[model samples]
Target: MKKRLSLALLPVLMPLLHACTTVGPDYHVPAHAAVHAPQANGPLLGTKHPAVSLAPVPDAWWRLYDDPKLDKLVRESLTANTDLRVAAANLRRAIAMYHEVEADNLPQASVSAATARTQISGESFLMKEKIPVFSIGDVGFSVSYLVDFFGKLERADEAALASAEASQAALDMARVGVVAETVRAYVQGCAATHEYEVAERQLALQERGVDIARKMVAAGRGQPVDALRAQAQAETLRASLPHFKAEQEKAAYRLAVMLGKPPAALPAAEAECHEEPRLRQAIPVGDGAALLKRRPDVRQAERELASATAKIGVATADLYPSVSIGASAGLTGLLSDLGTGQTAHWALGPMLTWNLPTNGVRPRIHRMEAGADAALANFDGVVHKALQETQSALSAYTKELERNLALRAARDNASEAARQNRLLYQAGRAPYLSSLDADRTLAGSDAAVAASDSEVAIDQINLFLALGGGWQNSPDVTK
Candidate 1:
């Protein structure tokens, strides 16, 4: 009895052992050559913010600027932006697709029933015309399975899972891009306001020359050309007035919309310096591994690579012959003369499906491999671009910092030069031409300083984008 039991179990266990063979290929992370990776270079600039202690990559990093209005606006944008909504929708779709793929693990069964009636003419195959109409119905359960004998189904599931992960990461990238844009637009608007004020002051100075020329002409001490030149200068400044006002208003409206508010409802600015935001500085460059992990687009690329790898297995499974056993058991009713009979029918045997993979399947397998290769390259590209951006941003920020200092010095020098030249002219030693030259120099220098301030702020925004830090910080939506 023991021998017979062992003999009976041997055949059953034999197939089960071989069933472990996974089709196509099991994935391994592809090796990549790291290029121009950041050494996380930076010096701690000044005292760290009180809110930030050991640099844990704070949530809402933009809010660290300590501006309540800005904080509110960013939060509003996060909730209202249509582009963000689209990204989120895509994420949900990916999740559904993954779920659909996962459902393949279980048997799928459905039920059906049918009834039909038909009439045949005598001319229609004469012998068949004698048959009467009939009603046919079937009620049964059948489950067809590929058996996952080689983990083929599971590999497909893995591919779907990777796709879902990629979608989620894409949403992160979108989040980073939009908030950076919002912050930038707001800063530009504020800077434009400053430029407009400068134009106004210059226009006032030009008006003074117009008045002086009128008096000099009445006393016969100045030419008409002098008054004409003064008028032209004043008009030039006036012409610029509309442009700056338009730009500032545009920025303000954009900001209001981003904050999920009506464009007409922005609060008045108290002080220009107070409106000029200085983001939390001493930007910490975290670990390379962590940086890679934090980047959504990079992760999405890697996930696509994984999905492609699994496809290689799915394709390879086609190369081998598939053997399946099938059986059908049902009831049939027949009526002959006055008799009715019910019978059972069934068939059982190994069914073999065979075809050479090299024929129709080889091209597909090659395609899958090619796709995987492309995905790997894309992954590498994203990593390289990310690193490059951070490096470039750091260099840019450093330069802008230096540029701001130089512009400040230039502004001071030009301002003092104009004041001194005017004083000397009042003391009757400097000519009117010298005073005019000094005024023009000071005005241009002030404009340059204002422009440089905007550049510095813009560079700071770029750094945030390069680092892909918005997601880490839970950035507010861009309305």
Candidate 2:
């Protein structure tokens, strides 16, 4: 009897062994093929600037700055920044969601227990007379699995996995932003401090000039107007010191917030940085192809496009019938006879479900199709924007470098000229006014150089940001 029963079930179980075909269009990375080729008309690589290179970027690009404090701050922020924490949480949520979708591919099993009291009517088939209340107890175990005849589950899993990947890319993007912003704030703080020191020196020199002008006037050798002019110049230079001081304080507060602390809190070393950060080495930014591959936003958009494509397959599979295999084993007897052999019962069979075309089905497919179209467009737009930002950053960085170099030379000449004019005036070979004018020019040149130096560092940071450098250590997502 067992052999015959097993033979009878063979036909019903045969289809379960066959692989189901995946339905609908398979996903391809939209527009990625075009990005692989180097365009001759692409933005010019900065060969003219000695601080620029075509070498591949380092994994820890910030280390190239050679600032240990900066490196430490970046590491700390990576671990504690609120934005990164949020992004990481989102990624975890996506991973959990993916697992939830994947669980649908496995068999579902459940167990249940119940107790009920009921009375049958006198007119019921089991009751020839008035019936009293009766109590019944039951327990059962059931297992069911939806067979993927058209790959609906597979497509759903694919979409879910893609979403997880996109979330990971978003997390990486957040890291890049935080690192860049932290570096910018640190640099700004240092530059502002340096500017303040320079302003103080200029103010002292102007005050000395004012004292000299008053002495000359008291000795009947200089005009009162000259002394007034000297005092006014000293006050003008004094006015700028407060602005730099404010900027310095603001930078410190920004750094504190970026490190995930209160705005008023800051590390002592970071707060006391009074010298501008400088990079002595060239930046190794690889070609445009590598840039396109490295940017997280581009990766995220590509993943989204893939997800939208997978969803179309999921929707398409709904057009076909669904099949499920189910089985149950249970006991049915009087409460006192639950353990007896006579209480055993079992069942197994295939179940089919089909929903005929409804008015809403085609519209739902259309909505999915529209979503896919939007994703494709968005991916294309992201690729183009990434390239644009990279080119723009490169242009700004190179031009700022050139300007910084020019300002350095100009400052040196201005300093020497001021010193010579002062000596010549004291020796009676040049006028006092000439000396004052030279000193004023020197102060302006010094301020310009300081500002340019800060700008160059910021532009360097921007270039790296545009290249998406901070996420190199991130784990690769499984597509």
**How does each model score on lDDT?**
0.68, 0.83
- How far out, in Å, is residue 85 in model 1? 1.3
lDDT of 2 by residue, 1-479 (tens): 54566567667556644746898689986444445445722534664567788778787888898889888888878877888888888999999999999999999999988777777688867767887777766889999999898899999999999999999999999989998999989989999998899899989998988998888789877779878888988999999988998999899898888889998667566667888667767888887777777889989998998899899889888887788878899987667677688888887776667777694666777888899999988887887788878788999989987888899999999999999998886676776788889989999999998888888888988998988988867433322
Q: Measured by TM-score, how close is model 2 to the native structure? A: 0.90
Clashes of each: 8, 0
TM-score of each: 0.82, 0.90
Candidate 2 residue pairs in clash (backbone atoms < 3 Å): none
The weakest ten consecutive residues by lDDT in model 2 span 35-44
Please name the candidate that would achieve the greatest TM-score relative to the true structure.
2
- Report the C-alpha lDDT of model 1 over 357-476, residue by residue, as the tens digit: 658788988999999988888877888787778667767777777777898898899889988976775565766567667777877887788778788778877866776767754643
